[model samples]
Target: MLGPDPRTTLVWALLLDWLGQLLILALIVWIPPALDWSIGGTQLAGQYPWILFCVLLYPLLGWLFGSYTVLHWRRLPMLVLIQRLLLTAAATLAAVAIARWLINPGEEVWLVYRRVQVVWLVSLSGWSLLVRLGLRQGMLLPDTPRLLLLAGDEERDRVLQAWRRVPQRERLRPIQPQQLEAELSRLDVAMVLTLSPKIHRDPALRSVFQHLETADPRWIRVVSPERLFEAMQERLPPALLAEQGLNYDDLPWAVTFSIQAQLKRAADFLVAALLLLLTSPLIALAALLIWWDDRGPIFYVQERSGWLGRPFTVLKLRTMAVQSPGSPATWTQLGDRRITRVGGWLRRVRLDELPQLLNVLNGEMSLIGPRPERPELEEELEQHIPHYRKRHWMRPGLSGWAQVCAPYASSIEDSDLKLSYDLYYLRHFSTWLDLMILFRTIKTVLKAGGR
Candidate 1:
């Protein structure tokens, strides 16, 4: 798989982007009219209708600017994206200006002279930029090449050579077959993009992979150089095939849910509300301890990758000191030094994450689903973890099936396996499954399973 398939992500992103633009436009429409404040008095009174035309123009400009496509490969070069956005805004404004002149021929030319369209253009561009940039940076951390052990050295070299021509090939590490199993055991290998043509002849590799399947189902098992390639390519349609960087497994939600999405939303709201009410006391205590231990703010509100790859601020009790800021959007570990004494206890009891209930209430997360991750981490994982970004289809959660089933994940490989459990949850997300997870989460908390 090239990366995370983002079809569903694209749909939701476009919807939200358009919705946000409409809201801003609506506000502009009502605010000035409500105040009875005309923009230049006479001619501008009902003439403000053109503002709506300008407003509608902005999001269309954004779409053309590639705002919708930024999340496709996890991170597009920021400068390049910005440049495209600016150019698109300019073109869109020009088009709008032409249309305005064509429609309202004889209106006072002085009124049109204000160039107030710049306000809509700049504001819309800025807002869209922030949404895209914040979202991209929030969910996807900087890309670090993952260590990959290709089981077929000859085929691996060929694939590596082919991909190396592309400049963004920093995300994969091709290693020899002899070193594969040990690396897999060490949890160092992000995936085994196996060109296992020799699988028919080599019982050894097959047996090793069988064991690996139990330990890490999320490991990439690519059979390079023949039938497997054709199988994968044939599966997807051509138009969809062009955006081929993402993987099949990336969209767990599409494969998982067969019913209406309303049920999931209702579950999230209800569960998040209930959890907030029930855990208020514990949350307060956790906040006090966090403040006392670190002499800083109680909550750590960092952006996490949410449903459809949108950025949402995830709430957690501050576990780290203010001085030692986290490596920009990295994953937490079992024994990270940034953890304060009280914070450590809070993590053990899973109390630190109580504040995520606020995120759930705000509709930024779900009650039970795949754990929302740092933006940077998600980007890195998508590079090596096949279908990694697919977990973003459903809203991220406070407690998840993967969180319960997997041990504390300290590395990318650990994350990959946890993804299997996450995919399982995405495939089987329902009320009963959520209840099961909730019940199990109670036991896990009592046992101090989190760290």
Candidate 2:
């Protein structure tokens, strides 16, 4: 029943793309010399270094852009495919420009570099398109691993509808209650996606769950209806929290206090220090702008709930005017008149968040976790949202899964959705997942999609 893990699929796809690019580079180098056309009056031998540089850099950039992420390729949309190509080309060109300065290739070599860049852009784009098309048509690999669904009629229909929207829908096989035992005994099912509440309560089904767990601990996943919709939107699903007589102590908190927690803390400190040093000039510029605009305080400090629901002073570059007298705590909305002209640009590019790197370095926040909420909002949301306080199970972050996936939570409904994403992070916390969130955050900043 064991099959290729979804995580490794991305590595395989990346290797395939690199191979295709290598072939194109070889053709570009070999064919020109065979035809007696001197590329910028230099032999192809000298171009190998630059070609090798690109071969190494392309995959790194692809990974940075989430091009190699399994989620991206599993349901490859046309727009996402195009975005990957664009990011690849952009990264390649930027790498070339940086190399040109360092290598200081003379005028003759510079001409050759420009020519190769043009050819590479055209060939790589065409090759990438062909590879993606091949993957979509299933010409590059065998059929996807099949998912066995165990659920009641209503849940079965809902699960099927969700899977239908996924590009890998053909891999799912639904089993009826009467046929479940027989199918389990005979079929080589790799994964079981169940939505039936009975599986958690009924003695017989609970035994099945235990047997499956004994066979492969990760094989069976009890997903909630809300999780099903989240998956359809391509967001990671939160762990099912609705269980009979569930206790607060049953939550997955070991990860928050494990060796990985230590590693995350070290990373936050080191990375935050490095970023603060690198962005000092920009921070200075922002301060000057804020001061010039209204001569108000350049930094805003407020109390927010952090790890374990403890209060901490969070820092931010002021992005709004000084509050008028008697104004109450409120969420920043789109087109809010309180935003100064300079602050608007800072918020758009997320420059206002730079100061929080200090908080990260001080051990009060991590680079990736749930965004901290103000005390006023936190108190109100805790009263309205289920499991709202669970978000404090980990340190609050400067950028997180919810910030990247959902818009700013300005209402109760938005807060509910944001909590779901936060819980998903807590349930599935890992170094790889954190890296994905960081990359997505970069993409978001590049697109000016910040709040």
For this target, which candidate reaches the highest lDDT against the unseen true structure? 2
Give me the runs in candidate 1 sitting further than 4 Å from their true place: 1-260, 324-327
lDDT of 2 by residue, 1-451 (tens): 2334344556566777788887876776677777997554434555667767778887777766666553444466778777887787787887788889887976645333667776776687777677666656655454443456677777667556645543543355777656665655644444445545654465667666666565644444445444544443433322234532233354444634767767888899989999999999999999999999999999998888998899999889999999876577898788889899999999888999999999998889999999999888888888876677778988999999888877888787678767777877777677877898898888777767776
lDDT per residue for candidate 1 within 1-451, as digits (tens), equals: 3333244455555665666666655554556567885533233455555555555566555555556656655357878777867886788768866876787645453223344456445666677666676555433332221435354556566544534322342355666557766666664434535344454357766776676557655544444433222222112111111244344454434555635456767777887789789989988888877777757888877888888889878767887777555556666676788788998888888888888878888888877878888787777878876667667777888888878766777788678667756755665556777887886687667757678
Error at 348, model 2, angstroms: 2.8
Minimum summed lDDT over a 10-residue window in model 1 is located at 232-241
Candidate 2, residue 391: how far the Cα is off, in Å: 1.2
The CA lDDT at 260 in model 1 is: 41
lDDT of 1: 0.62
User: Model 1 misses residue 391 by how many Å?
Assistant: 1.0
lDDT of each: 0.62, 0.72
